[model samples]
Target: MSLLLGVASLSACAQSPAPERANGGKGTTPATSADAPAVEAGTPDARALAAIRTINEEIKVDRIAAAPLPGFREVVVGGQVLYVSDDGRYLVQGTLYDVKDKKDLSQVGLSVVRRELLDTVPTKDRIIFAPPSPKYTVAVFTDVGCSYCRKLHQEIAEYNKQGIAVEYLAFPRMGVASEDFKKMEAVWCSQDRRKALTDAKNDRKVVAKQCKNPVRMQYEIGQRAGLTGTPMIITESGVQMPGYMPPEALRAALDKLAAEGEAGPGAAVAGGH
Candidate 1:
């Protein structure tokens, strides 16, 4: 169930074919133009599968369903959504917009996938800071080394006061081998995770410890979910609000979404800080 796709690199390959191993450096023969005709001779699904394999043989096809775009099939590779032509000759990566309805069809589709993925992480695996009776819950992908992540953590009390529960998921942008990952591991291993995380956010020295922890698993999950930055906030409804939002502003935005009865891609609100 690993969804860590290097789509960005794949997109780059589409423009200029990589000179390295055709099998993505896995020592296997890469698919070429000659392979296309044979793949096309098979079923559309087979052809689509072959086409994506040509891009990255390691790509895991999670789901394949009808796309919002006609004559295209939506393929969920890992957690990233891709639109493939019915003929399986074409592949699209990026936002698929519905101009008439003013919606991002790709994100709308991704929201569902995200929710499903997040649901797999049990409550015990998360580091939650919540009110006695929370009104809204947001899963925040955070890195302790990230400044904005620290800023957000500094206001954990405020967020809780606003009746918005913050459930933290580790996302060490520096990778698992980095010091930040070890720091997070120590935090999770601590007897009091909330206190440890707060102390780490404040740049306090945390006694390093190791134990069975979800830091690495959560980091991989974030990778699968196509997370590009820290402080990425995802609502219970799976709408992503990237960047940091102040306590009051965040509560207001949540209220606005609730009032409007919407939590789609269009409902996503961005904040500079």
Candidate 2:
């Protein structure tokens, strides 16, 4: 069960420039003398690295190989996988849709990466909530003030009835110093956090509290996992559900994932798109 939250409040950070058409044509321009070395078929190691380096100076190429599709290369940088045209003329930052299978395999690949990252973090370091009977377990980074987060909290019973367990991690939308962060810290520090969280979500005053909490660590984990907002859900198989899902719909989606028998995370949901 993924919780949904608004990211409209968070300030946007600088990102890499979006890919653009250089020649305003259907095909790429012929390589000029100033261009990097040409990429040869079945041998993309050296030239691919050079091309990626030319495009982004900060990127450290981890691996470069032929992509599943023709005329493209898969470039792995610091564990993030992105596709680039053979000549480095185009770069794709979004998922690659498989028209034949009608699936988003790019998400599957990213799930493997997310799972690996999550595995490295200690589960004990997080604030957890378990269902009496568990069929699926999802980790979520949450902020109490987010309206969608409250909506998800209200549906907790429905999710549990569907055999989906919800686990909570701190991701105070307002960084460490904000009142929201302090309130979350109070929740984590409370002797009965479940009750405190419920109260806070309901707009009750959170008593001033402090403890050796893992809230900061969890925030860092969320960032490293590529979570940019509260309620970023991570499934047991490491697939990310970035927004909220109604109980019935979420159950059906989970059922579909099981039926498909895929070994990785499921496709991106409509809300996420």
Candidate 3:
């Protein structure tokens, strides 16, 4: 079922939009007039870009295109795919359904982008907890002060016992300058990091420690990856599971995702808060 849906989603992306030419040029050409701004290849015009920029200044518009229905531009905002009208009058936040195949094509596109963005964070910078024998590896962006994050930490052994290697990256949740950030830095800088993380997550104050750390960089990476909260999990295949999931549920999800070979948005099951 999912395989057919995946194929259809891929097809939709392939057929999205072609570059528009101005002044009868073979390719997109710059124009001085407001009505005839240069349209980038496979993207919308300057007018649409400006309109989208006005709505959400933070949204990094990668590409813009007219939707299947006219007057709307499918805007790829950072790694979170969304759609906006060409006139910037309306914005759609949910996934677009491909009725024929019962697939969420919008989610498929976002998953591809999310995976690419996750790869930008260097693996060497993370604090890894590897199982002696691993079956799955998941990268997690976590805040030291988040309750749900602490819960996930409590199950570290269970996850490892199930052959899932948990790699931790600092998310902070609070800005880099906050107390939570400092605590995370302490944990990362400790003589024994794994122990420090356990101690901190268990509500113990880690002895003040400092060193050159990648906490800030990890936070920035999370921002660029559209992570607004703590405990965001990313599987080896680039599937994102936001928030926390119980050990048993997480193991089952990992198994299913492994079997499927791909996961779209909302395919992940959440653990308790």
Top candidate when judged by lDDT against the true structure: 1
For residue 117, give model 1's deviation from the true position in Å: 1.4
lDDT of 2 by residue, 137-227 (tens): 7777788887778888888888888888778887776666568878988998888888888899999987978877767666655554556
- Write down the TM-score for model 3: 0.70
Clashes of each: 2, 0, 1
The sequence of per-residue lDDT tens digits that candidate 1 reaches over residues 1-273 is 223333322101111112111222111221111222233345666667776887888665655667878888777664477888988788887677767866667766566656766877879979999999998899998888777888888899999999999999877667655688789989989999888988888889889999887776676566555565677778877776646788998898888767765543335422111
Candidate 3 or 1, higher lDDT? 1
lDDT of 1: 0.69
| Clash pairs, model 2 backbone | none
| TM-score for each of the candidates | 0.79, 0.69, 0.70
Full ranking by lDDT = 1, 3, 2
Indicate whether candidate 1 or candidate 2 has the larger TM-score. 1
Task: Give the lDDT of residue 131 in candidate 2.
Answer: 70
